[model samples]
Target: MKPRDLFVLVGIIGIVLMMVVPIPTVMLDVLLVINISLALMILLVAMNTTDALQFSIFPSMLLITTLFRLALNVSTTRNILSKGEAGHVVETFGSFVAGDNLVVGFVVFLILVIVQFIVITKGSERVAEVAARFTLDAMPGKQMSIDADLNAGMINEQQARERRKKIENEADFYGAMDGASKFVKGDAIAGIVILIINLIGGLIIGMLFLNKSAAESAALFSKLTIGDGLVSQIPALLISTAAGLIVTRATSEGNLASDITGQILAYPKLLYVVAATVFVLGTFTPIGPTATYPLAIVLVISARRMQTNLSRKQAEEEQMEEEQQIEEVRSPESVISLLQIDPIEFEFGYGLIPLADTQQGGDLLDRIILIRRQCALELGIVVPVIRIRDNIQLKPNEYVIKIKGNTVAGGELLLNHYLAMSPGFDDDSVTGIETTEPAFGLPALWIDEATKERAELASYTVVDPPSVVATHLTEIIKKHSYELLGRQETKALVDNVRESYPALVDELIPSILSIGDIQKVLAKLLREKISVRDMVTILETLADYGTYTKDPDILTEYVRQALSRQITLQYSDRGDSLKVITVGPSLEKKIAEAVQQTEQGSYLALDPSSSQIIYHRLNEQVSKAIQTGQQPVILTSPTIRMYLRQLLERTMQDIPVLSYSELEPSVEIQSMGVVNL
Candidate 1:
């Protein structure tokens, strides 16, 4: 039988037994007598409630059974009492336990018990459903947060599951404390004092003034007065000890059985004390075990209050920590910074394109090299390198990496932290993510499949394409003709479409989804027009993906700047010689003069001789270097200009596309120390 059922059964039988047997005059106003049974039933219900408070059919059945049992016992007792004459409840009722009356009353009790048990058995599922609904409906916010974490690759599927469980457990725990507190409220000391006084006075008064002649006195004497004539206090002691055990179990760490074990071991002394106390109460002196029960109830409720508060405090702290993590997504900059790239020599960008006619490498390597060449061409720089596969082979002007999404873990940072914390489960050495570049590992990962599944279940539909596309862009491009298109190409595409056709830009699917629809206007610049002005616009909008856009008018002002510039860098190879030069407006003769002096594997400067070329000031040195396939040199601070320079420099090296939007050209070098060339 369930502990709850046992509690109700014991309580009903004890109450009926009390009424049918006899009430000693002194114990007549025993208002607290019902407490014994009530306390146990609450504790039993509490045990179930404490373990799992989720919506479930069992709790409904359990609750219904408890209420049904109480109703039946109350009705039956009231009816049976009303049936008898004032004095003799069936002198037949007095001796009822031994006779046919006993058999009849007990059979009725058994039938009711069985009927209620069956109802509980049948209604169990509905009860569980109710509990589960209650648990889930109670924690929508926490559930949403868990879902978000799961979707964001902050936590895995299993961890999300465990987090939900923790939320449910906390809800149940505090809820039980509230219910238990209400059930046991009253003045504990007063009840204990009253029980002591009543037992002692009743025993002595019944023994001295009452005779065995009357039915009532005879009944009281038979039930309470032992053979030697002292009051029988065993029943009250049993109730007190049970109450203590139940309270200790609920309020302490030990399980019910453990509490019972401790009680049993301690009872050697308790038994003697109760036996002696029985005599004292019978002699009309008041003090003993019955008094202790009420006080135990008080202490247990108080302790329950304390535990609930502590758990709540812990839960709040955890919530704050989670909030901090979610906020950090402002940029993948942290991940990039941790990869150890120096801010001085290194630069990162977004939405930039590669120069098509630049250095030689496969389609992939070409993309990387072109970005650097573009950056170098735009800013005048002499550094381009690529870190792909596991080695850092030197690319004189370009390089590229082959990345497989399936093999890469999505929550690399989270995984790294987990490994740091747990010594037994630390196997994160296989991720070949790029950390050498300061901008490498820059939160550019796609939302994993695991994240999508979790978010879907939680009803957090994909709000942005990055919510679906960012994680697998690299993989998608590989399969779809989208090889990491040159940073400059991407920038140019955005510039051309956006400039050439704003509506066309709006209609064209974004080349990448990580930076979402919020960047719609910025993307259009690349589709319709290709120019320096459009390039700056693309750079300005790089890291805003996955976030809400707050400014619209400001974006338009920047697009015009990228399209107005008309400076171009040129390169060529003839026989045993390589030629490099810069050109703008009208400088064909200057380009020829510069081109004539260049040799294979050697560098030459392109001095723009025209007035318009000087006005443009596009990095002539960078143009020459990109054309000749040599490292470009740019004299710029660690700011937007520097970032632009770095973008082309690295593309010259071949890694991934870089853009003006990907980085800040801040002159502050505090966060980014110097880097060796």
Candidate 2:
């Protein structure tokens, strides 16, 4: 242990020994002075702490100081009764402070005991009890708030853990304070008892053993008893006051002195009223102007100075804000900040500010939170925060969604109207303004509220302005989620999985496949609108086949086959049957033969003429499926599934290209159409 720790240990042992050992008068006097210094230091430290946790050791310290005081009382009582003299410090306190009046000395000592026991000690104990109870009761709510912030991505895991630890420490500190306050109350009562013992026992011993007269014995014992009582009770009073300060201290930005001055001086105009009141009392009351007039003049002058200072401070603050803004514009860091782009941005015209402003009753911000949560559940990736702002250049009703600084989608909305789409039939009576749905490009009309109910009754799908924006934003995020998952995001996902399945991650990462390779596979899956939420199954398949092949495209095909059940459930209607366009053998063979292989990877190198003819035929079948109100799912063999997907990716990015092996055997498949060449 360090020397300071050893010193504290030895000091506590010595304090306990003082009760039994016969201490000399000179040593006793020094000990008494040290006790007073310690009490003053404790009180000062307590006043300066901004938070209770800053002095968390105070409860234990209270018990130790109480024990030390009791030990000092024992030593002094023994000396006073045995030798009729305690020490120089005790004697000075008795003669100089009490002034040879026994009744006055006793009364003063009694008053100190009463003030400490009844006022400061009682209040400190009550405050500690209430604080402990409230802290324990608030623990669950504080924990839940932290969890909510973590889930919403407002704070990371480490910050949330730290906040939780602080709450636990606060609860424990208050609980300890609750028990330690009892020590102070008991110490007060013990001081009163020790006072009576010294007085009576000193008188008895002086008369019987020292052979002193009754009058002399009474005078000597009374002075010594009062001196000892005064010495002990003064430190106890300081300590009890410190305990009160600690238990009542609230968490603040400043220490006690600063908080008092800053808050009390917050309103300088109120000082004028106080100054006026002081002048009235001084001029009219019988207490005389000589005493109060000087204070009143000082108050008036101070109020004037404070008011001028307040005005100057406000002006300085405004000037500082302007200078900071100017500096920011001229700084090189400003240009660097502009170079960084948000992953997703939703910018609207000034007229649509109400949609994002909470004060205007818009739930768009809340809707975005739910959109991010829904995307996490559906796409299995944490979406970055979407930056929202108002753009002055756009039209009043226009808003746009940007991905990585490029505008991918935008639309116009009429705030006071609802967009109603026809159910394959036009409703001429329920129309207002014609438009196309931003998300799906369906023909719709912006209908007013008067026409909303009528349009609903007429079998039309009607949606308000905010819902339109929310749906459009959600679709854009889902479409561009693949672009957001880089190597860093992929590593985050891997770490999340490693927490639960360490061996699998340990075997696959950097051993069979690197993070970039896993990222490519995940991006491909997301590009095809597949949920990688089933990370366990995905990683298991990669670990099983990763050694044989390192190409992400081929590995993705293998993972697809492993996730057959999930894909089957995704495409099937009612979880029982699937209807799709089947690729003919002739077309499959033609595409398979045209695929070129090199050291890098494989790619389809079909001639321009053959590609055109294939595209024409595939489009015809897909149009027929869509016209028949059926989803255009193209089913092909496993060997050419990826090549065919690459072939159609540019023209038909939304169509899902599935392989025969990627479908479960239990699901029934019906061929709606076939593509042949």
Task: Please tell me which predicted candidate would have the highest lDDT against the true structure.
Answer: 2
Which TM-score value belongs to model 1? Answer: 0.28
List, residue by residue over 65-90, the lDDT tens digit for candidate 1.
33333332233233223322112222
Candidate 2's displacement at residue 185, Å, is 8.6
lDDT of every model, 2 decimals = 0.35, 0.93
| RMSD (Cα, Å) of model 2 | 6.7
Worst 10 residues of 1 by lDDT: 225-234
Query: Could you give candidate 2's per-residue lDDT for residues 36-101 as a string of tens digits?
Result: 999999999998999999999999999999999999999999888888889999999999768868
What's every prediction's RMSD, in angstroms? 22.9, 6.7
**What are the TM-scores, per candidate, against the unseen true structure?**
0.28, 0.72
Query: How many backbone clashes are present in model 2?
Result: 0
Q: After superposition, how far is residue 337 of candidate 1 from its true place, in Å?
A: 31
